[model samples]
Target: MRDYLIAFLTTGAITFVLSWIVWKVAIRYRLHPEIRERDVHKTPTPRLGGIAMFFGLVAFFLISTQLPGFAIVWEQPIRMWALLAAAALMVVVGVADDLWDLDWMIKLGAQFAAAWIVVGIGGIQILFLPFGSQVVVSSWLSISLSILAIVIVMNAVNFIDGLDGLVAGVCLIANAVFFAYSALLARDFDNSPETNTAVFITVVLLGVCAGFLPFNWNPAKMFMGDAGALLLGLMMASSAIVVTGNLPPQLLADNDQFGRSQLIGAYIPMILPIVVVLLPLLDFGLAVIRRTAKGRSPFSPDRQHMHHRMLDMGHTDRNAVFVFYAWTAVVSLSVLLMYIGTTAGWPGLYLPGLAYLLIGGVACVLVTLPPSRRAARVASDTKASS
Candidate 1:
């Protein structure tokens, strides 16, 4: 726990400092592209924030190796190196796209290549079924599913990087939730190196996002661009793969059919990582479908994202971002509570679940409320004077 806190703070501080440096460099180099019609921000902002985040990730891993509790990660050099290599590849691709617009095919190919590096080289493949009695999968199927999962998560996060602080905030919450769960698994149930690595990855992710959020929030000083978005997506997907793929086989066995059935019925944690980002996935799928139905390429850029819709429905920039954040928190925490219920029984479920529901419900209502009545009254009075 102490090591985790140290890792988080160290990584966050490094990323925060690096973010400022990157911002200045981007401005000096005139690295930002001209604002497009579909853009939400009026002013052009410096990008390449991902460069800072990538460095932060590297720094965290290095620092972790020196920490007594985290040093065990160093034993698995291949896995660590593979993740870094894939992240570097994505960063390069993202930086290129930010500097000079690349063709869609080139970006897509790069994503696939990075996925292959993680799954094939790092050996982080999804090998279990979250549902059904069956758990283990064939090697070919595991590899294929792992790649597909990585691609989906990568693109989902990239697609939702529409608002200032939106992606960063969402990723921070999602990673923190997963980190908590991973830490629990490692500390109590599974003290394996694999679980510890997952915790480390999540900590790194949480730190980078925390460090970057200040600059990326509303009235942004800089944008993360594709570089930050893709890198974040990759890290999140990698953590999920590492945790899920490395689970002890006994956890997934059907030795006691009734007990297994009961556990499976409530054990949403197995898929909690994916569920936490379901909003982005849903938005991405809808965008593709909406574009294809209009006889346009699925990748065609547009202003019809969930955030865009919020703006269209009269949400201010900050309000829209916060609304999305609240929804994500609700979904993530709800799933987390369900997982606790699965392991700790009904009493564990009711209190936290109800509290989350009440708080989340109120937050959603408040965020979704129309423009203030006070403001409306002032507008009417001004109209009358006119």
Candidate 2:
């Protein structure tokens, strides 16, 4: 408890102070995000908020390692160093894009490099396979799987950072939940060093996001831009991989009766990440499908995201961001309840969370008809000008 408090306060303070400094730099450099024809923001806004987040993460880890309660936990600092290295790479790539507007292919190549740095060099890969039988993936397969997961998570988060404070807010909540799970896992599993590392990273991430959220909220002073968003996504994904990758095999065993059903149950925790981040992944998928169908690049920007639909439904920017925030909270809380209810001897609550996903996903679809479909003539005119 004491260690968690120290981590939270330390990281939060570092992130807040650094973010303020970055905001000032953004103003000084006039690094503003322009309101394009398809943009939802009515005014230009400064970017490079990610630079501050990067500093916050670096500073927090540096300071926390020296604290009495954190010293033992920080003993194996190689993993942390690897995370920092990956973040630094992403930050540079993101900053370059924000300033110079790099092409999509170049940005993507950098993302792959960032993921590989951690998976290949950092040695953060899930080896154990629990599907009614115990197995470990080959080194090559693990490397490929880790890189793919990290890249997907990194891009999903970047793509979701469209609205004010959305990514930061969602990340804070997600990390908080992950922190709880880490602590719970730590409490449940005694023979693993990964638990402490997982908790430490998640808490630091939570603090980093908390520090950035105030600056990122509605009527924002500056955007995290690609740099902040990509770094954040990478950090979150990296933490998830570390935490679950180290789980004990017995804990992952499937509980069902059917041969295949039991196998699937064992993979639940491994699969939960994709499910947890389904919104962003689904949104990205839809965006690609929509763009490819029209012979346009998927990277093309437009006001056709989940947040944009909220805006079309008469939500102000703040309201729209908040609405999304509320949805994320509900989904997260529902999942928590389901996890608790099922584990603590009650199985009824799981349905509610699954139901919510179906309802919310359908609502998002019904409301967010593509801008091309809903306002085709207007879209054609807008594209013509662009």
lDDT of each: 0.84, 0.75
TM-score, cand. 1: 0.91
User: Over the stretch 27-136, how does candidate 1's per-residue lDDT look in tens digits?
Assistant: 89888998888899998898789999999999888777777888776777788989999999999999999888898889989999999999999989887765554378
lDDT of 2 by residue, 45-156 (tens): 8778899889988998888767777665666677778889999999999999888889998988999998998888888887766655546778898889889889888888
**Residue-level error in angstroms, candidate 2, position 133:** 4.8
For residue 375, model 2's alpha carbon misses the true position, in angstroms, by 23
RMSD of each: 4.1, 7.2
Clashing pairs in 2: none
Question: For model 2, how big is the CA root-mean-square deviation?
Answer: 7.2
Give TM per candidate.
0.91, 0.85
Candidate 1, residue 36: lDDT: 82
